[model samples]
Target: MQKRAFTLIELLVVIAIIAILAAILFPVFAQAREKARQTSCLSNQKQIGLGVMQYVQDYDETYPTAYYYKNNTATVNGGSAGGYVHMSVLINPYLKNAQVWVCPSDALRGVGPDNPACADWTNITQIGCEAQVPRLSYIPNSSIMPRKRGPQDAPNVVSMAAVDAPADVIAIGEMTDFSNCIFLGSTGQQNNERRNKSHRPVNAIMRTAGGGQWAGQSVADVTGPIFAITQAAAQGAEGWGGPADTRAITNTAGCRGSAADGGLHIRFMSPGRHSGGSNYMFADGHAKWHRFNDTINPNRFLWGRTYFPSGQPVLDQAGVQVR
Candidate 1:
């Protein structure tokens, strides 16, 4: 038999077909990879939620404070670390696995035991993390977590009994990159005492609006960005997570102003990092994914008021939760 080779036309056709297949399959492959990551993130959320529930049960049904300033003791300021003790530290005894604190899809990967913190100058170093603003880290619901910001005394925690609808309240959410506080959307500064120091506390949009640094403010006029634009436009332009109260998709300066100045909080608004949605751990010890807009729907908003252990609703002055 005589040796034969493919004709140029046939070769060209083969190459073209391969190119077409590559184009068609590349996006699908990418999406599959992303889906896996999202699933992994959800798994992390579920484990964390269960761990938190365990912590609550152990702690007399009280939830952990999201973050609190470490008081300086006689030992040394070096050991005191002069920083806040994060919620991740408080619940680690129950979590057991530090790895679950990180989400696979999290570009920031957030802080782990990789960063240690001091409970106080007298206490030894403990598992904790520290990060600057404009980061995509994990966040606990301030409404439920109760934070002790700055030098003031740690505020009382919201007990499990106070959560009227555990399933409806968001306990922990992924990617705190845009939100400055570890306590997601709780109010502070009751009785002229400053807690969670900054106007940033009120930046969550769905925050309980009562006396605090944001005493007189209102999210009523501040429109939800998803409502301001078409769904297609929002997905393409902002993809969730941006500066506080901003509707302009082009404006990417989420960290432009001081969180105390009340001009920014991009992380809370643009929280969804996985396929235009994010994972959340609900108070009822359930974790799931949700489209960002659905969480913010006024009829059933998930980011607002929880209650004090005394059964008083937070942001009590708002009569109804603000935003």
Candidate 2:
């Protein structure tokens, strides 16, 4: 038999077939990987839910505060100085693992100006006293636990028993860099940043001896209106529509938008961080993957009874009917 070499046409055909197979299979592989991440995220939330329940059982059924001043009466305006204690710090003991503070899909883990990645959460013994707290991939429900202050000028701590429905109350969700925000007023405020876009840097007030010290402009806080409250209390209610396609997603460092200093803002808006939707945990120790488009009934699933009481019409940022 004479040795023969393959013709150029045969090689080209083989290459074309391989390329077509790769094009078809690569997406499937990517989707599979993403699905795994989503599943992991859901499991993390479920564990967090269990931790929360355990915390409630041990602590008289009160949900942990998001972050609070050492002194509750130390108003930011009054120049009262006090450190902040984040919810992660409080919940970590229950979780006993620093890994749960981050989501697998979060790109900004341990990222900041000084740190290349998020700081190791293992040694974070104190929260409010530290200049920067351990960055987390999840955010607490500001409706049940307000960022700056609780409802009616109360502290940002709620009794778990107070919620109308524990199963419907959103405990925590996957948060991105842009998700760490608080609403100050409407879009028309004097210095308020436009909604649904990158918000203006907020002037953070660090803890100082006599009062709150101006820490300079912080990219962590975004001020707007309180949508988590009922329609009657939906002050500055409106949808902040972003013009750009990527505007809805969080920044790479996980610190994309603005953050509140002294936790001075109202509601914590959904970051739309995850693809299609986001993963959230309910107060009743159950986790659910909520699609953004499918969230027509904003009653208990979105925030809770405190924010969306029964019979309230679910509206978008523009005050249009969502359902």
What digit string (tens of lDDT, one per residue) describes model 2 on residues 223-287?
21122222211111112122111344223222224433333221233434455667878778899
Cα RMSD to native, each candidate?
8.5, 9.9
- The TM-score values for the models, in the order shown, are 0.67, 0.64
lDDT of each: 0.51, 0.47
Candidate 1 lDDT by residue in tens digits, 1-323: 99999999999999999999999999999989989998988888888788889988898988877655454344322221344455666766776566777777765466332123233312424323232221224667655765444422223467888777888888887644432322223232121222222212212332222111211122222221112122322223222323222323343422322233232232333355677777888888899888766765545667554333223333223254423
For candidate 1, which ten residues in a row score worst on lDDT? Answer: 210-219
Candidate 1 vs. true structure, TM-score: 0.67
